[model samples]
Target: MGTAPVAVPHLPVGSRLLVPVLAATGGSGRTTVAHLLARGLAAIADTVLLDLSPRLASSWPTHLAARRATGLAALPPDQPLTRTAVRAACAVEDTGPHILSDSRAWHAPPLLNLPELPAAWYQLASIGGWQAVVADTPHPLAHDLLTARHTGERALTRDWYELPYAIPVLCAPATADGVHALIRATKTLDAEALPLARTVVALTGTTDGRLPASLRTALAGATDRTAAVVHIPHDPRIRAQGQSTAHPRPRTRHASTRLTDAVLSAAHRMWGRPMPLAPQPAALP
Candidate 1:
């Protein structure tokens, strides 16, 4: 979070934004940040949480009690997804963001890959008129990107990082090892000439109190390369119970609000205009 008070930034009317929760390591609190961002953003935008994690690894379906929804698998392979189709494939709850993720059991085989590219998923969300899409990208994708860069074959990397009006929230645990991994990932993205300037660094607290001296010293070197560096406070419940749709503690929500604000600040910088407020709903007679 920045030194100033967090300002709420709504999406400009008829505009959409893709906010991908990206990370270089697992257990860096990627999905939890994505969920919190989605829930917080839902108050101002038509938000959808796209759980791009593997089927057996997905948490939203179970957390939301939407185990039977089939999620991504329910979409037809031969057709372009319509609003109705996307809605049907999602775990449409009465509140919070709609979830579109693979909810299959641990033993299931690989599924079909229509909307083949990473950008295609964002397009589907746009087609469905979602104002915001928070994609919980698979953990391995970052490692793959780094590998591709090193191997001199990065043809497949653009769609994930180069989408129009997309904001990348880079997450990592607030630890010496975790910060080192994050720095490496950032350098990779920078070398590839992706929009690293628009990125947000989220340091998920692995423990309480001041950051480890080593981690602080590491982050100090890379602070200038990002939009904002926000600390996601460690939540004991999340650490103990994992992610669920239930409300988080107040401080956790505060951190989430800061992250959302940073994202909106980055979006404002990208688009260069003041965002319009969401319209008020009509009251019942």
Candidate 2:
């Protein structure tokens, strides 16, 4: 009889992972993608969505504010508050083992000082026992603010690579002009910070399966290194749903779903583990 195969031990259900998804430009559907990815990751383990953008809190679900107040009230007056306060404030729509937080709310003028931000973030991550943190940050603004705080001791004129985390995802538009514009912008950013080519995932927005040939040619011509490209086809339901206050009906071909899959796939590859897939729900006709 053949010897029994050795079985490998399984990884704990929740392993800490930090993923930062950024846009080449504003309005590239970065926030939408970040939220969907958070929801999808929740399917696997406890996930927290941290939106570092300035206006993230205003657009967040209503219940989030009440939650923050409750958590804040519980803290001792002398002790510094952790970033988890932001997460506690958000009303979690699902009972799944996840906490989705819009970190943008924490970006108020009071929180702008760098000394407080990083310390708070570190403390929050340590205390929450979070399995993963998916952060959505404003392009240059996020990078600049965090960098200034991290290296406040150094002269501002000196070149420094300051960031709370590495950028793994770089989202861009699918149009030729968009790609060209991004390429130029990436070059400028690379001069100061890390290269965009090192991104593990590059998501492009498209209207249909048909991608612009010019954009394809430009990406091909460029020597910038990129791991993969995820095409997000335009879906009217996403926009139409956003127009109304009601929770938009989730659709099968929704752009968020595609974006989430790509992010999770990238995470799986990086961690060398299989990520659980979100259940597919039936779409309304």
Candidate 3:
């Protein structure tokens, strides 16, 4: 008889890290950065990418609708929405060392009122060794403001101070025009949501070298809780591969190498230990 398959242990890492990546603007490469970060964190510990953009029409809506269709939606709306339901619907087979969950589908305006669901999902992910929860936040200031208000009113059964974990990583494109737009949007939101600033992640497109002074000032002016900037060069290689859901491609061998290095550096700054980088294949001709 063939030898029994080696039983691999579940939950590879000891501790979990939650990292939310949002954007100040819409096209600031939030999704790309979130994916990159998840891939990077996978090297050291288990990583999951939670896409929180409701507009993306991800699986969350379908799952929620299905639950309602099956008459399960009436089962105590106050109860936190569990991953059991979502996992079942999403058919998440690969709960391997790293799992990236796109949580954006549930961010719909209608779902925002369903506070228990998002909170419950987050809690479940935390318990499941989800080391990193990278979020691709929305663009408009209204989005953040509404989220904060709704989150407080609906999901603040726990200490209000701990809400930062649920906050997203805001991304702002690295163009003069984009940055200006983001500044206006963030400023308006900052008037009401103080924590909004902390979640901003500025995304600079391929540039010759260092960040520009104007963009730096614009980011500093924001009042969010934390800010991080990631620079993605304008590489035809990435676009040619069509990095979207319909044509998802693995990070290019060259990009993967640099991304791993950058992620390691960021991880050290954020989580103390630097993780091993993912292996890179030979560059394409």
- Largest lDDT belongs to which candidate? 1
Cα lDDT over the full model 1? 0.75
lDDT of 2: 0.49
Candidate 1: pairs in clash: 1-230
**TM-score of structure candidate 3:** 0.53
The digit string of per-residue lDDT tens for model 3 on 139-211 reads 3444544565767643221212133233344456667877776676566445654445334344546444555
- 188 Cα displacement, candidate 3 (Å): 5.1
> RMSD for each model, in Å, please?
7.0, 9.9, 11.3
Model 1 CA lDDT for position 51: 79
lDDT of 2 at 53: 47
Which candidate wins on TM-score? 1
Stretches of model 3 off by over 4 angstroms after superposition: 1-14, 53-117, 138-142, 146-161, 164-168, 185-200, 206-227, 244-285
Ranking by TM-score: 1, 2, 3
TM-score of each: 0.85, 0.62, 0.53
Task: Give the true-structure RMSD of model 2.
Answer: 9.9
